[model samples]
Target chain A: MTYSIIARCPHTGRFGVGTTTFSLACGRRNESLRPNVGISKSQAFYLRRIDPFVLNLLAQGYTPAHIARLLEEDDPDFEYRQFGIIDRENNVFAYTGPRIGQWAGQRVGPYYAAYGNGLAGPETVEGIVAGFMSDPDAPLEERLLRGIEGGRDAGGQRFKGQRRPERSAWLRVVDRLDWPRIDLRVDMHDRTVAELRRIFEEFKRCDAYYQECSRDPRNAKPEEVVMSELSAA
Target chain B: MTFSVIARCPRSGRFGIGSASYTMAIGAHCDGAVRPNVGVTVTQSAPLLRNNRLALNLLAQGFTPQQALRVLAENDAHYDYRQIAIVDREGAAVAHTGTHVRQACGQRVGGGFVAVGSMLANDKVLDALVAGFESQSRADLEDRLLNALEAGRDAGGLKGSKGPLPERSVALLVWGKHDYSDIDLRVDLQDGAIAALRRMYVDYKPTAEYYEERARHPRNAIPAMEFADMLKNKQKAMS
Candidate 1:
């Protein structure tokens, strides 16, 4: 099962998606982000095509709702698929198939959408939505992570009648660069939410290095930086 | 990003693979380098593209699936993290799932098929795929292969960490006696990749048959319009 959040930071016009699944390579499979277009998450019987289709539609100036409608009309097995798309404008659109597993639902806010299936309960998705909506002051990446953590705290995924944290998780944030500003994953870990938090911490720590390298590769000196230094050096 | 099954038809000596992944074009990524009359191999789960080339090379050199896997495992230090399935030219199938893979990771070698998967929701995914293939002895190879994928999905093939997420991408690669695939169709990116694959196969069958007819009996091959009409007639007849 899975829970994911797709968000667009209004201040930066950046797109980001964070997802965790019981399966491996959640980073590779579930999340799809087009640098300037938007973010799409294909979960609950994920299909590789949904992300690309949604992203392309977003790039073509289709609203998230329009893209979702197109996918719904095209997919015969639409009831089994769950998807969420956030356009560059932060317009959120989401769908949960009728046949999806129990406790499946999605919550869409102004600039974000949080959803999950096979979750511990409705509270799981509720927590994720609340988390994302709660921290407008925080960075998009941080808010995305917090949303995942909130879901985890409320019960991330349930299997065999037991609640368990995600086994693999992924976070991707794209800015002006062709490459991702932050792309982190916990491929296989027992505590996916916690590991994602740590990875984000590391990503923030390395932000200065990335910035320095962007300006001049020679300006990035590893030893001169401190791990505790959170801001740009 | 993907789940795939590769097999050989013992009765017809045909080789085929069906796969689904998140990538837009999984065809090139999961080629498995299938050669007619040789063997087919699929390497996934932290896939090393080099391994696919290596396995194909070994198969072309007449190496047994077991032997090739042994050599591959020995040569790559990171083999423990990879999942590979091989079906030799002789229809001997074998699979290797590295220890580092996610839970419910393993492979099942059946009469004429080898199914392997990693990061799956459960081991039942492989079981359902094999069952689908075996249950349809009278069906065409393509139908059986698609059925197997459907079975895998029905068994909750692959899932996200928090819930059962369906497979994102799907591909079906099949070859008859020819070197090129008779049915090489991919629904590379779609919300219903498997469903799209089935529809594509139906729509492309006449085209595939057109090519086959051209290759085998060029003088008797029908015109494009005629072939399209014939397909429409066939669809009407079936309906």
Candidate 2:
């Protein structure tokens, strides 16, 4: 049904999620992030509230594992839900509902969690975890993008019922702001992961400009910077 | 330049985007950001990811779709180089196409959607996109989006980009309240990419719900059907 990655950026201390699926907007329905709280994603029979709920508990100082246990205890439909949670402290956790679609599970790294349900095979999550862990020094958004790309290449969504590739994808990065620093989606596309890569390249190009604006929106002038990048491109 | 639409499903609280272009993977590079219960925003043409980030942030901060554009334009030094569209959770919409975009560029904002285009063969491409969405209001968000994409193709996509030859790239996206899209598909650097996209969607739609049910009630999830059986049906339908 879906594949997702949640991570804490060592550079900016932000939380991010990059996700995609055979379904529609996995980013919108699956992800929950709050500044200084934690990141949560509910997929595979996703319950939207679960993300917010996990964030609340994370804000209340619960450890990632504790929060997962608490959520499991609280939901009668827990068996139908797959989730991943990562907090500000870089604590990571994941769960797969007992009844989730085939090839459903997750992998956790020191500061990241990658999970999927209805995946093409085990390689999906494995590749995502490897990609996320590949470049520890990269920006959070880039790492997450790599993870999703890996998942897609290793066989993203289940193919038996349809096309081999997943149709939609989303990537989001957040820092101190209430809004996402990079929020992008391919809601319906055939080459979802490849498209995500192109958009991410643009995001990387504009990141410095975004940082400049964040520093001083009233006076920030990114025209020179952007024009320079365009020339270079 | 490209032709694209961002639409909402009033019935299912879904948001979809469909676009075609002479460029490679135009939908991926310049598509929008969607938050299921919040809103959607697209930044295209001389697309600036910084402005796109700003727009999505503004939308999250409770700016109206119109206000978000105003704020972005006010802050961007190269505002005229951008094209943007937004649809709030409540279905309100707004769009902006800058003068700096390629010739034949424009955007239309309707009740719950926006269609924007640049370097189009004709203004009718956008019109066809809108008409496709309107005429197929009863279809699922994915089908509606594909309909719009198909109509835009029929109306002619990018100028000098269409013939018996295939499109360089195309993409379709539909977002519901799930972590995954109801449909997230793209056709990049392919001949007949639009046709390929339609075929891909048809193959996926029927089984989408089975996976959804697997998520909601795995206890009752259907057994994996044989791939041969699924292909037979697909082939039969194609015939």
Candidate 3:
């Protein structure tokens, strides 16, 4: 019922997660991020605590693979959960428990992991990887968006003949700052991926402006003024 | 950058606001306070968050929507940059769209509802919104509000350099007899925000009663997961 990509952007040192699900508030529940550290996503039969715990382990200098082993060793309901982790070093690890429904699996790449449970097929995960790898030089936000869009295009979560709408989607990216560079969510939408794309386009226009505002409020132009300038240009 | 509808439902005595904006976090900045059994207010364009609370406070003090708008207009320094709409408990509606707001900005006052927009593609957006709401007079308040938002979008929402601008955020809020909102779905920083809001409303509608029951009588309420499974099975059977 969920698909996701957790990645580290080598170019900008940003950690990001892109995810979609046939559930509500996937953005709020599935992923956790720590700037200058790592990112983790715990889905499938999501336990809200797993993401924070994984981040804690990363903070304690544990590798993603080591944390995965610990989870398998300790968690009683390990078979029902799925996890994807990416560290600041760009090391990636992913796990899909056996009890997660059919069409579930994971793909670990150089700096990212694409994974899903109750998907249409393996193509969904493959598409996510291909999209991420399609443009290595692109900004992390764009690549994350493309990855989820790829998953959507390749037929996202499904159970047999019943295709589930991607009801919720989120894109979160954090830099060195305490706040996220981008935290966009479509909590519930029949076409979550497309809606995400639309907002991304709009947000991109002001993305830099907001960063400027945060850094130098005295010198920053008003949002409306900046928007009008863009429109005129 | 924004368009909204504030309305009171005569059938259920609920108050709701549906709004979309070409800005991030419209739910937090544009949507006003919705006090159950009191009134609802939305302040857009160059919105000041404090105005929402102040309007609600005035409404709670038995001030009419029009009177509340006048007070807000007088106290606000950037009055010309604001667009506000209010719907009170008695079904009276009032709105103010300042002259300094962008082109195609206006407000429409109708029976128990006020529709307003700024930086819109055209003035027809408000007309379509009102028409959509009026067409669904017999439906639930949420349905009517959502329909109006969709209609506004169809009529060309915010103005853009090329054409109609895509909405980045949207929210649907409704306050019933309870102190808390009955439905408060938001799609913050997303395009096709209105559509997303509608989808949320659809998904949440069936669960609303369950949530209320759990809140009021937790011991008698079934486990949420079990209830969800039951609903899923019922949906499967129906399909």
* lDDT leader: 3
Off by over 4 Å in 3: A212-233, B1-22, B26-185, B189-202, B205-239
* Number of colliding residue pairs in model 2: 26
Question: Candidate 1: global Cα-lDDT?
Answer: 0.71
Chain B TM, per prediction: 0.88, 0.87, 0.92
Question: Ranking under TM-score, best-scoring first?
Answer: 2, 3, 1
State which candidate, 1 or 2, has the greater DockQ.
Answer: 2
Task: Please list all clashing residue pairs in model 3, or write none if there are none.
Answer: A199-B191
Q: Chain A TM-score of each model, in the order shown?
A: 0.90, 0.86, 0.93
Please report, in order, the local distance difference test score of every candidate based on alpha carbons: 0.71, 0.73, 0.79
Compared with the true structure, what per-residue lDDT tens digits does model 1 show for residues B1-239?
35677888878888888877543345545543576788788877655555666887898887888899999889877677678888877888888887866566678888668877765678898888888777787777777888888888778776545555555457677777754455665543345667766765666565544544443343344533355557789899999
**DockQ: which is higher, 1 or 3?**
3
Deviation (Å) of A229 in candidate 1: 24
Highest DockQ model number:
2
lDDT over C-alpha atoms for residue B83 of model 3: 83
Fill in the DockQ of model 1: 0.02
Q: lDDT (0-100) at residue A20 of candidate 3?
A: 90
Per-residue C-alpha lDDT of model 3 across residues B101-154, encoded as one tens digit per residue = 777889999878899998788889989989888887999888898899999999
